[model samples]
Target chain A: MSAAPAPRYLARPLAAIGRPVLAGLASVGRMAIFTLTVISHLIRPPFYPREFAHAIMTIGWYSLPVVGLTALFTGGALALQIYDGSSRFSAEAAVPSIVAIGMARELGPVLGGLMVAARVASSIAAEIGTMKVTEQIDALVTLSTNPIKYLAVPRVLAATLTVPVLVAVGDSIGIMGGWLVGVNRLDFNSAAYLKNTIDFLEAADVASGIAKGAVFGFIIAMMGCFYGMSSGRGAQGVGKATKLAVVASSVLILGSNYLLTEVFFSG
Target chain B: MIELQDVHKAFGDKRVLCGVTLTVPKGESMVIIGGSGTGKSVTLKCILGLVTPDAGTITVGGQPVTKGDRDAFLARFGMLFQGAALFDSLTVWQNVAFRLLRGAQKRARAEAREIAIEKLRRVGLKAETADLYPAELSGGMQKRVGLARAIAADPEIIFFDEPTTGLDPIMAGVINDLIREIVVEMGATAITITHDMTSVRAIADDVAMLHDGVIQWTGTVAEMDGCGDPYVEQFINGRADGPIEAVR
Candidate 1:
């Protein structure tokens, strides 16, 4: 007798779900192991000073032009948008103050953070990911060098220090962008716009943005290095890791931006 | 000398290395032959500390490799990857001098470049090739560059993973000759993993067959062809209808 019709469709979906769940769990486990390994290596010695310097130069110094340009345009566009929106309520006079405060407290840091995350995160991930795929990381390990100490720590440290600096620069440039637009497009006097911007912005606003920059920086570098070290062994694996690093860093920046804004602005 | 004492490695439910035990005396060339996915590469990785064994002790020069001092253990060896995994970002010279450009081995930039060029020349590459990136080179050239980099530091122990997998017959012979010459010149202990019998005949003083994650047969090159094991016989003869079944 033919067996009762087997539930083929049910079995397929069940197996599909089971496979992804297991894969997700395995990925999480691998991430945890990698994180612990990196932290452990950070505490060890024989640190490579030269590699650290190179990372600073590569991730921090080389990234300034793009960060600067992005901030400048964002600030200008923001000022124009504020002007256009505020005119409906006869609040055009508030444009300078709003632009200054907004850029310093949120826009500058978050946008700048996202920009750097896109640029630096992809690069770091691609470089390290390729190294991993090709067994260069293994070669490093064989050469008596701790891969994390030689690779991750330097990039992470550089990003942490450099991103805040980029934020500060971006904030200033963004404020200037607002000033230029406010004076030209809005027909506001240059002196009055500058005074309003300076008066409305406080040290706390700048500090908060810089602090956010530091956090974003950490996330960018951490995600890049993390995905890189765990990349699979092929060109496709490196490409996938690079794409994931950028996407993850951007998402983390936005999410953490909200949390940080709440913490800083809660009072 | 390198010794693997009953090593076993498994990934989750899939056991790759069941009980692999082998030895390479100092200054000897040992070639491990196996088909794809039979754990040949894993064995080399385990010896290099890249892949840890589930149960085994690997010792290099009588020092336990499982200890925390992987760097110290690794410093004694150099490896040529299956893909000739050269750094694409760096120029050929920079890739060759990767180790020399850092730490105590750090040389003056010019000296480093010079040495890198010299190594490149030894591998039959022109000095002009030193400024080129790995991507600009053909597969055979990349393999030669990889060989040059492997011997760049004059390592006491060397590992060659599939040295002749993707090359033409003539290029493969060139690589085999280079490997043999380098092993003899450096007086280094060499472990090569490949299925190429030509490479085995050219470079190996001893031959080991890896099957089911263990050394199924091992003997001197002279004795390899005469090994009575059916697996060895099938593998050396390239016969499909023998003990080894095609997975298809």
Candidate 2:
């Protein structure tokens, strides 16, 4: 027997729900295609060495201070929280191990990635969006230059290579922050805290964080370029693209962090 | 010759171009005149292959614009955008010499700079203006720089999209005269899209009136005034009441 149709009142709610779902899925498909295009361009020839060098400096060297500061503060706060919790069970001595593991496996890469996304993604989107609006991108095309090769590839490659180094440095700074809190506030011996952190942190934990960082970097650059290139006209269009790039990159960073953690530790 | 045969394009529900057919013979200056949002620019872009048409075809020198080597085809043409659209980061000379600094037209740095300076001088910009960025220059200077950049490679075809839009009367006159002189001197085929009647008279060898996504009239500048076509007469005379609607 044939099924009866839904009631008239249900149609409005169902249509409202289905509309956004369809838009969201379509957006995801577009982003996937954009990512593949970027990958295809990455392996092609006619590389721009000068543009590449400039991107490395912009993405890597310039992002160092903010990443380091975020890691330091997060580590210090983690140490304090761990000490307070552990002391309830007379396990205050466990602060060093817990802080070390937390900073190395989670806080360092996630916080550092978020900071870079805030700084880099917004700027890339604004710059490229403005270019698109002003027709400089079309100008580049009329000059017989490929916009993807000239603009997207170098920036994406630079971000992918640099964020891991940022994460590694952030991990070290975070550990140092935890050490300082452990020694001065918790009344733990410096030598004992250092030994505990060193012993408890596994190589795989730090490696996994760095790997997460690389993925985050790729996401940041891709979101920036995709939104920028597809931005609408005028100042409002540029502003919207910039906002979307940062928001999307940040959410993706957090979501991917969870998935990466699950993959690395689920077994 | 460049030819567009029944080219059509649409964005969502709004149809921009519907069966636009026209031609510019070799080494002739063809100015397309139409009201705002009438697809004058789209027709130019279709010929340049910047915007793809949903139907019909465009060709340059009897070869389809969509086929063969894109770079080789583009190398034959240069364009001055309505906003000048200079690269904000590059200095005047660098912006002018951008095409020369890379790709197949790559030249020695000194040579490219020399050519850039010469083009700047040709556009009536002084040597001192070369080092200044686009933001540092006045609107007229920026337009001149854009014109210089378009001619830097000595392209065989050149396009001017609203070349005098933002300039004062004197500056507008200067730009119109410069475009005419350069097109003649270089023997370049020219396709300009402008509604500026003064510019039309100054630069056009032949004029085509585009309205409602089709050519309403076509003739030489001398014939434009007495063409007797309602759309062309209404547009050239700037009458608020006519066959064309005032409000888009």
Candidate 3:
């Protein structure tokens, strides 16, 4: 390619095709390195306890209501849909088992992480991006504090520790939602529904879902920090970072869920 | 003393600093004056290792700037940013005592606060202002807070970037005076970058003019008065027509 004198049509189309592909690959590589750097910083000394505590409260505790509501409605609707579909085949008894398995394997952690990504990632990006624009990040460095250590490490630690706990709570709320719909609308016996749900759920299933929650949480926090740190010097730059953080985290959450599911559940 | 030799830096195709060199002797204030985008800030950043130069050797106290313990190196210096850059999440006092609150310089809470309040007083801010966040302050007040923060740690060296950028003339004069007084009181090595000629006169023990990524002239303020260099003359007088293009 470096030695070639290609025709305009061929060169133009090829260049257009190659440019985005190369850019995409380069971005992926950059994100991978950023994730590694965050992880590396985690084990280092001089931890900022106050910042970590603040992040835990913000990322984990404040996220509960939204994640809880999402899980509850989703589980109840899933139970309703399963009952309707199962009745066609006279398989209505499968509703409880299906809801439990579905919530445990997929919806609970995936949806909870998505909700977190939307809320926390955008906030982190905007906050840090504004810091970058206003030179606050540079101020951190000039004060002998590393920006990554002060900003990214605490947030990442908080998300990793809290998202799984959020997933656990979300899963329980979702199961309860399924139970409510089953007993009230589907005419399912409450005792039997609860028993089937208990019987269908295994320890491995719960663990895998929690594990996925951790990975998704990492992706969300990392994207927020990376975009924020790399933001250009203006209000528009910060806005773009906020937008990109949300979009990237959301897409990554869904995509990683599929891959995680395949690893944990596929034959 | 801080010395930069043949420093070269570029962002993509546009060269910001090319073969630039200068020296700031110990315990003296050196003000770098230039038009916008003339690499004054870039030079300051390179000395502090905020922006790595593509090529050059920068030495602080006769040691390479890029080597040695970064935290230890940075701790020796303080900086006042163009926009104040006080952490919005922290109060004014916390911003001032930021270096004292953690890491190797950690001080007890009371001690840190005492120092912060003293610094604030020295910068002409009231003790009540300590508890207020940066958002609560006016632009001039923020600049004062920034000055207080820069002097908080009693650093051996200090850098000020566009210290009077947004202040009114009176406030600008006040800040310039405060900076001059503090630099004299501390007897610390100082480097300041500004396009404001008034600030240049008020703060500089020595002056260096940067133009098109190179040092156009360097001398004491008295020497600068009649140096007879066209670029320096035009910049100092704020003339429209000169060797430098107004649009470029």
Worst 10 residues of 3 chain B by lDDT: B239-248
Misplaced by over 4 Å in model 3 are A1-4
Candidate 1 residue lDDT tens string, B64-116: 88776555566678899988888776799988898788755668889989999
Lowest lDDT 10-residue stretch of candidate 2 chain B: B41-50
lDDT of 3 by residue, A1-267 (tens): 577799898999999999999998998999888888888999998899999999999999999999999999999999999999999999999999889888887899999999999999999999999999999998999999989999999999899889999998999999999999999998989999999999988998889989998998888888999999988779999999999999999999999899998999899
> Candidate 2's interface RMSD, please?
0.6
DockQ for each numbered candidate = 0.57, 0.85, 0.92
Chain A superposition TM-score per model: 0.92, 0.93, 0.95
| lDDT of each candidate versus the true structure | 0.89, 0.93, 0.93
lDDT digits (tens) for residues A1-267 of candidate 1: 977865998888889899999997997787678767766776677676777788889888898998899888988999999999999999998998888889889888888988899899999998999888777787677666677888898888789888999999999999899888888887999999999988888999999999999999888998999889878778889889999999989998999999988888888
Q: What is the lDDT of residue B138 in candidate 1?
A: 98
Locate the minimum summed-lDDT window of 10 residues in model 1 chain B: B67-76
Model 1: lDDT to the true structure: 0.89
The number of the candidate with the highest TM-score is 3
Q: Residue A249: error of model 3 in Å?
A: 1.6
- lDDT tens digits by residue: candidate 2, A1-267: 999999989998999999999999998999999889889999888788888898899999999999999988888899999999988999988898888888878999899999999999998999899999999998899888899899999999999999999999999999999889888888899999999988988999899989998999999988899889988899999999999999999999999999999999998
For model 3, residues B41-109, the per-residue Cα lDDT tens digits are 999999999999999899999999999999999999989999999999999999999999998999998
Worst 10 residues of 3 chain A by lDDT: A1-10
- Cα displacement (angstroms), candidate 3, residue B158, comes to 0.8
* Candidate 2 local Cα displacement, residue A205, angstroms: 2.0
